[model samples]
Target: MTTLTRARTGPFAADYAALKAAAWLTPARERAWERLQEAASPSERRGNERWKYTDVRPLTSVPYRLAHAGALPGLAEVKKIAPWDDAWTTLTFVDGHFAPALSTEPTGRVAAGRLATATASVQSLLEARLAKVQAIDEEYFTLLNTAFLSDGAYVHVPDNAVEERAVHLLFIASPATSPRVAHPRTLVIAGKNSQSKFVESYVSLADSDQHFSNAVTEFFLDDGAQVEHYRILAENEKSHHIGNTRVHHMANSRFNSISFAIGPAIGRNDHHALIDGPGAETNLSGLYMTTNGQHMDNNISVNHEKPHGTSRQYYKGILAGKSRAVFSGIVVVKPGADKTFADQKDLNLLLSPGAEVDTKPSLEIFADDVKCFHGATAGHVDLDTLYYMRSRGIGLEAATQMLIRGFAAEVVERIKLPALARYVEGVTEKMLPEFRLEVPK
Candidate 1:
């Protein structure tokens, strides 16, 4: 693996200085700073693996100022986005720092809070697992995030402990002046026999401020543990987003994730899951809607390391205007990973002549006894389906809307949470209607 070095001095000189002066700096943070200092600066249309599908020139062109931690959002504003159900616990972070005043820590079974305020006992756990699941070496954005991370939320679920309510985390980037950057790191550990749900939301205050958000989340699940993770990205239209999510599943553990991408000038999501124990299972699904000149990419890799593990992934994208979308997924079965069942599929719908899509789905199985399959498809709406609906008395626009809603419904309906599923569907409806789709009563 190639190690990325940090930048000594350049356009980010003052930003680096401010990071060093920040009061929340930690040893790990310092290590990240040193690593980024050695890495080369970003450029327009760089063909690096991490930046291949998405060009980050616009983000690097502007100098983003450091957001003041003192100006974090108030409790009332945080609660506005909270889940309607009282059973769930909510945690809010503003400008990358956790706000305890706007959070609720579930009783006894779990511990949740800012890394800075965590006790030495909890910090030890974080230190042991942080940055252990994913490789951050080749990705410059991940390195940048590690270097500037001040404070973020942390959740730990003990062995055999079960929580009835889900955990909701909201990260808000509010910039008072100039462009701002926020790096939010989240770590989750689920012990054996435990079950939980995690929901994360990323939003920005200003669309034209040229903000950049780099986020990383790691999850470790023990035997028999079940976890459902949901990520909603609705940042400003002019913001740049680079996020990485890594999950490791042990024996009999089950992991599920749903990603919704609705906003961002440019977006890239890197997701990877490893089934290291027998009987482990995983399900990953995502939906992205892009318009105007926005760009969105989703790259996923699943590794089956043991026998009898199963995994499935499905992702869909709707692009209009001159927007572009990309999806690359790979499933690998180790030599001894017999009876591993894996399948992946990606579907992209282009709503405009100029919209573009790049999709590649692949499967690599070393074990003869494994069952794996992959498929990818990119095309515009089916005119036949539209004509059939119109023939049945449905308006052309209404028929078009129905087709899109149905295409997106396939993934959104899989969401187990009722409220969240409804919210996601509502968002899709609003965004899809703009593509000359008619709403069916």
Candidate 2:
């Protein structure tokens, strides 16, 4: 991809100046701005294999108003959207601005979130981790996130601490009179031997407003640490979502993540986990379902830099109507990284003649002794199976929905948290009706 210039990053031009004028500017942000100026330009996307399947013009052409601390829904309404009450700690943001009134403080922790009123300890973690992450450095969106960075929720789990409850970082996109955008950032620092669960969700308060949510989340797992991560993207059909998630795993640490992309007119998310030390384990799974004219893209990768690392990647997609989706899963093992076991797979099902999907699952192993595998498949449901269900007196739509659920169950069932699983089930079930196949007579 060709590097972008100041005028080439079209969509953010209108708000770039405003973003730089903020009084809380930092040296890191200034450096981010410089990098963003040289980041990838969408104009050259079609020629790049990474961008060949998904067109990013929808995200690059629109002028956006900077999201501010404006009017927002009350706590009761937000609960209807998020619906998670048993969280160990809850930190909420509206249009990327912290909502202290709606957030809850953790009772028995050093500090849970970074608020303007954050404790000194929590503030220290934010300063150290936010702009210093170099794991998945220098992609276009990552730099844009830092260049326009604002207030964020920083979750810090101290060394050897066992966080009993999950941490919820909920971000809402409120309706706006004009096209608006926000850069929401979340950083989780799990100290050595500590354990915690993290949930990062994106939802819209308005049904069909034009809003762009550019969000970035990073996880720093120290040695022997364990972190369970869940990322959900369910926004209005008229909105757009572009996000980047980075995970840095040290020696003997473990990371398990499940991501769901079930919304947005146009969406793109990049998830990368770097196994920087030996004995680290990473498990990643994702599901994306699209209907109507929506477009969604998921780019996931696991990089092993040391020996004895293990990683698993499984992703699936269901496409219907005229919708489009792209899935790219990759595993890379560096030289001398022996005994690294990595496997990745991507599967997609098309339910309509107009539906389309592009999936690529690959492995790059520099170590000859490493065990690596990758596979990808895209196809429609079996006709005989559908007919057999109908022969058993099940209606066509009901039979199709059942099959769709069965196909997606593998990834959904991966959620270890019961409460979050139920919530995710509710969200995924609501969108099943949209995936019914266009059965021809």
Candidate 3:
């Protein structure tokens, strides 16, 4: 195995100074830079509360350069990653640059497109909210995103409006020779009494020798608003992916988050949400599959800051080969936030003896009259189920795949959109054949 050389200078040393100002996003970009300059490198971060169970030195070691627009991918190639659906409007970005020729602009009671073409109101909204949700000083990659933020998309759903079709943002990372990086930012503003569904997916053109994609997406849901969000991640073993997402819920608003993950050398997902209003609810669930020697990490937290708020975090993972996965989740109910209800669970199934999983599910409750609980379990496939399948004339490998699919059904079933769920199932089926399967000893 080839090892990446550690950087002689501090991480992302030259990359920060090279960020040029954009047209309208210059102010926010400059602010992020000012804060990032004072932030500590990921290597300097050492603790169980934040950096436990995952090491990102190899990722930060590679000298990083921001990716410029490469050749536009053909429609067929783009569709291969995410199939086209008439009921959904699509926005495609290739190597961090918005690809207008290959995307379908959102229509009907919504204003959405590249930031360069945003209206004054939308641009102003982004200026105030770009790095607002995730403080730049807190996380290294998130601050890096805003500091070097070049190009991305934005959406605004009007009050009392219903976006008839789901909006899909497809970010494709093209193959590169060097360890290039792309900071793709997406901002969604849902107005009061509005409702919409969104799909955000990350796909690689192919496995590159060295590549990094640091993406951040923020969604703010106003009172009585409802948002159903689905996130999909598919890179390669040679590339690295870091996804940071923040969702804010207001009074009477509800949010449903369903995530699917596969591929990448070191894939880390940071999902955080704040239930800040009474009668608000959030349902968060995800399914991640790891194979070969890949490393996948999911760090999730939901903070209930108001009374009568509800949140759920349920995640399951299937592991094969010698891969390792980590799930660290927490539910925080602050003082004065009484009548909060929260539940969390993480379950893992290991197909090979060498495969491993580290799961930590916990809760911090400082409020009275609240209900919060968490549990985690890791184990191997059941031999009795294999025997039963074999008696029914199922081949060993096929039966194993069937069991893995069955294990993930609970999370997949939670996807409320029928068409989207079917598409996710199809993608999962395609990835099943590539797993480096080994019978549990």
Candidate 3, residue 259: lDDT: 90
Q: Candidate 3: which stretches are off by over 4 Å?
A: 1-15, 134-136
Candidate 2 has an lDDT of: 0.82
RMSD of each: 3.5, 2.1, 3.6
The whole-model lDDT of each prediction reads 0.78, 0.82, 0.83
Give the CA lDDT, 0 to 100, for residue 36 in model 2. 73
- Sort every candidate by lDDT, greatest first: 3, 2, 1
Question: Which residue ranges in model 2 land beyond 4 Å of their true spot?
Answer: 1-7, 10-14, 20-25, 115-124, 135-137
Clashes of each: 12, 0, 0
Best by lDDT: 3
In candidate 2, list every pair of residues with a backbone clash: none
Q: What is the lDDT of residue 75 in candidate 2?
A: 86
Write down the TM-score for model 2.
0.94
